[model samples]
Target: MSERVVRPVGRGFLFLDSHPAGCAAVVRRMAAEVEPRTPERRTALVVGSSSGYGLAATIAGLARYGVDGIGVSFEKAATARRTATAGWYRTAETAALATELGRSWTFVNADAYADTTKDDVLDLIAGKLGKIDHLIYSVAAPRRVDPRNGETYQSALKAIGAPHTTKSLAFDDGVPVLQEVGIDVATDDEIAQTVKVMGGEDWARWITALQDRDLLEPGFSTVALTYIGSELTGPLYRQGSIGAAKADLEQTALNLAKDGVTAMTSVNGAAVTQASSAIPGIGLYVSLLHKVTALQTPVEQSIALWDQLTGETPLDLDDEGRIRLDRWELTDDVQSAVRAQWESATQDNIAEVADAAWFLAEVRRLYGFDVPGVDYTAETEVDVEWPTTA
Candidate 1:
C-alpha cells in the first residue's frame, strides 16, 4: 500500500481532497481486488470516467487492481488549447502504463447521452474484449440536448422565479465573493431536453445493446452514481428538474440493474467527483462534507466506495437499495451542521461562514492548480494514447 500512487497519475490526481479519497486508493489493491470475477477476461467499462470520481474509479479498476478497462468520457476532451484536458492526458498516461501489466486500456471520446455513441460502444466491445464484467456510469452534465427536438437544456441553480444571492469562493484565489445568481426557469421544452439527456434512457439503451451483443456476463453488477442531496439543495438539486432527472436515474438503475445477467446491480455512489465541482454552491457543500468526514468520521471515501461494492455487509446504504458510500459528512448530523453554517454565511457577518479557504483551494487542486508540488507555469507535454482498434 505504501508503494501505491493514486490513479490519473501526476495530473490532477483523484480524491486529492483532504478526506476519504474515493476509488483512487482502492484500485491500487493487489490481484484480488482487480482479478477477473469470471473465467473470461475481466473487462470493465467506465462511462463519464474522465474526471472526478469516475476517473478515480478507472484508476482503481486498471492501475490499482490490474483490471483492463474501456473509458467513456463525455464533455471532457483531450484537446486542451490544442492539447488534452489534464484528466484526459492523465487517463491516457494511465492506459499507457497499464500496458506493462498486460492489462489493456482504451478510451472513447463519446457523448454517453447519444445513441450513436452507444452503438459505437457496442461495436467496440463486440470487436475486441468480447464481454464486460462490470459497468460504471459516472457522467453528469449540467446541460443537455434533445435528440428529437434539437433543443438545449440548461438547469437552474436557484428556485424558479427567485433571485437568490450567496457568497462564493474563487477557484483560483482563496477569496470569498458574493454571487447574486438566480435560477433560470426552464421552459417545458428545456425541462424535457434536460430529462432526456441526464435521464436513464441512454443508460438503459446501453445495457440493452450490450445484452443483445452478449457482452454482459450473467450477474455482472452495473452501478450508476446518484445523489439525493440534503434539503438545503432542494431547489437546485433534489427538487428541481435535475432532481427529476435524478429520480429518473434511480428508476433507471432499478430497471437496468436487472436482466439476471447473473450479477447486475446499480449503485448510486455518494457524490464526490470532478463533475460535482462545476455546480454553483456545490464546492462548499462537498468541502463541508469532506471536512466533517475527515474530522469526526472513521470512514474514508476511498475505502467506503470500494467496500460498498465488495463488502460482506449489506451493500445498500439505505432501504432504497442505493449503494451510498459511507460518507459520514452526508449523514444528518454533519449536513445539519453544514446547513446551519451555510445559512450563517453572510456579507455583514462573514465570521459565521466556515473558513473554507482550505477546502475551496483543495477543490481547485483537484484539477491541477495550487497543489503543493505542481509547477503550473512549466511547459510540460504529457503523453496520451487511444486504444488501438480495440
Candidate 2:
C-alpha cells in the first residue's frame, strides 16, 4: 500500500482530492447514528448512490432495515499519482461494513444515465437479489448524454424569464465576502436542455426497465429526491431553469403513479452540498439558515425517510402527494428570521450574522476534510479498492 499525505486541493466547494480514511470515517459515523431494527431480507437499488442524499439513503437501508443493496454511481478510481473521488472511498467502506454486518452489498461504477448500465444492474439483481423493495433516485448531474439520440445536454443554473440580481457570498483568499450577483435568463434551447438532463424522463426509463425485467417487488416503492427552497431563492431556484426541470421530475412521479407504480417525489431540506454550493445565493442563504436554525443533516433526513417508508405510521404527504421533509427549513418563522438577517447582512457583519465558518467547514467535510477524528498531517493511503464479492 502506498502512503502519503493527501490534502484537499480545490477552491470554493470544488474539491479535487479525497482522503480514504476520512471518507471511511464519515460513512461509519453515519452508520453509527442508526439503530439496527429487526432483520429483513429486503433489497434496494439506489441510483446515484455515492454522495449526498443518495449515500445517506444507502446507509439507512443497510443499517436500519438490514437490506441488501446495489449502489449505482459514476466515480473515478484512484491512480498511481492521484486519489480517488470521495464517493469512491465511501462506497468501498460501505461495502466492507455491509459484509461485516452480513448484508450483501455491491457497488456498480458505471454511467447511471446509460441503458447498458441498467441492463447490467438488472442482471446483477436477477442473479443476486430476486426483487427490489425500494428504488431511490437522487441524481444531481450537470450534464447528461441521451442514450437514445446520442446528444449531450447540459443543465443550466440560469433564471427563467428575466435577469435575476441577488446578494451572494464568495470566498476571497480564504475569507468570506458579500457580492451582488446576477444571472441572465436562459434561452429557449437552454431551458429545454436543462429539462432534458435534469428532468424525470430518465427516472421513468429506469422504472420501465425494472418492470420489464420483473424486478419490482409487490408493494415496491420509489422516490426521487427534490428541493423547493423558500421565496428568498425563488427567482433563481423556484423560477429558474433548474426549477423547470424539477417540475418535470415531480410530474413524472404523478405520471408513474397513474400507471400503477408507487412513485413519489421527496422534497428534502437544504444543506451544504457540492451541487448546492455552486448555485447563486445558496451559500449565503444556507449560512444564514445555519445561524438561525438547526438544519437536519442529509443522513438524518434519510433515516426519517426510511422510517416513513417502512414504519407502521402513514407518510405525511402534502396536497400534491409528495413527501415534505423540508417543512422545518421552510417554516414561516424560520424564513422570517432568515430574511431579517439577510436584510442586514454585509461583508463587515456577515461573520456575525451568518455562520460562514460552519458553511466552509461543511464544504470541507464533503471531500473528507474537516472531519472530527481525521488527522490531516498523517501519512494516508491514496489508492483504495472497492470490495468485490460474487
Candidate 3:
C-alpha cells in the first residue's frame, strides 16, 4: 500500500474542534517541546476524560507524558442518534493511540456527576495501582444526575436578548450568514438546579470519595478548569448559571488547598475547546482571541499552558496560582478591540478582522482527519486498544 502523506499543518479544521486529538496535540507539544517533564509513568485520574480540556489533559497525562490514567466520563460510544459525538470518537481514538504508545488508558462511561463513578475508580486503583498521584478535573456537561436522588438536573446557557443573531458560515457556501439564536430565560429554580448540576458540588464529591478511599497519595495535585471571560460572554457564560458554577469551582480549588490537597488548584485556561463552543457569543470572542494572539505572539509563543504546570520551562504566575490563559486574551485592550470589531463586523470585513470561516475549519481539523490537501476518503482502520480496569 502506498502511504498517503497527509501533512496536518496545525490544529483541526475550521468550525469543527476535535477535542480529543486537539487535546492530544496540545499535550504532546506541552510535554515534549514546551514544558518538558521527567519521563516516568505515573497514575492519574481524569474526570470528563472524553472531551474538551479534560480529554486534552488526559492525553497529556497519559499519552504524551506516559502517565497511566483512568478517565471517568459519561461519553456515550454513540450519541442518542447512534452517530459518534465528536468527543466520543475522539476519546475512543485517543485511548487506542495511547495504548500503541505503551501507556494505559481507561475510559469509564459513567457520569462524573455520580458518587459511584469515584467509588468504582477507587476500586480500580486499589486493584491495579493502589494510588493516584495526580488528578485532573475537566468535566463539561450541560446536565448532571443527582447521585443522591438519581434525578437529572439539566443546565441552561444564557443566550443574548430574546433572540439574538450572529454570523456563521454555511458549510455549502463560505458566505457568513447571520444566524438567529434563542434566549432561554432560565427560572430561578432552574438556575439553582443548573448550579447544583454544573458547580463544584460534584467536584467536592469526587475529592472526598477518593480521600475516603485513600486513593490520593501525598503531593497529589489536582486542577479543575474554569473560564471567566469579558463582558461579551457574560450573558452566555460569565454571568450565566454556568459562570456561577465555575465560580463555585474556583472556590472549591481554594478549599481543596486548605484541606491539605495543597497541590490542588484551578485553571481558567484558554477559550477554544468544545465546551466553549456551546456557550453563546463565544464564537466571536474565540475568533478574536485567536486572531489577535496570533498577531501579537508567535505560534510557539501562543503555547500558553505549556509553561505552567509542566516543569518544561520557567513558570509564569498570575496574581493567583491560576494560569492566565483567557485573562490576557480578555484584557481591557484585547476585549475592547474585539468588541469594537464585533460591533462593526460585516461579512466583507471577516477576512480583515478574523475569519469565522477559518475558525470553523480549524475546529473540524481536531478529528485527526483533514486539511485541504489531506485525503481521508478511504477507510483506514487502525486496530485500537483501551485500558481494561487497570
Strongest candidate by lDDT: 2
For lDDT, candidate 1 versus 3, the one ahead is 3
**Clashes per model (N, Cα, C within 3 A):** 15, 0, 19
> What residue runs in model 2 are displaced by over 4 Å at the alpha carbon?
none
Question: What tens-digit string does per-residue lDDT give for candidate 2 at 1-390?
Answer: 888999988877787889888999989998998888887778899998889899999998889888898999999988876799999998899898898889888889999999999999999888899989899999999999999989999999999889999989888766889999989999999999999989999999999999999999888899999999979898999799999999999999988984446899999999887789999899999999999999998888888898888863579799999998899999899999999999999989998999998898888888888899899999998778766841
Model 2 vs. true fold: TM: 0.98
Question: What's the TM for model 1?
Answer: 0.76
Q: For candidate 1, write residues 1-390 as lDDT tens digits.
A: 111222222322233211112211222221223423222246788887666567666665554345566888753433322334545544554555567567777778777766677778878777767787778777777766655566666654433334334334333233555354455565566566566767777677777878887888655777776666666666666666676677787878777655574222233333434565555666556555554555321113323444445442456556776675644446678788777777666654432364466555545444444545444444444323444522
TM-score attained by model 3: 0.78
Q: State which candidate has the highest TM-score.
A: 2
Candidate 2 CA-lDDT value: 0.90
TM-score of each: 0.76, 0.98, 0.78
In order of lDDT, best first, we have 2, 3, 1
Question: Candidates 1 and 3: which is better by TM-score?
Answer: 3
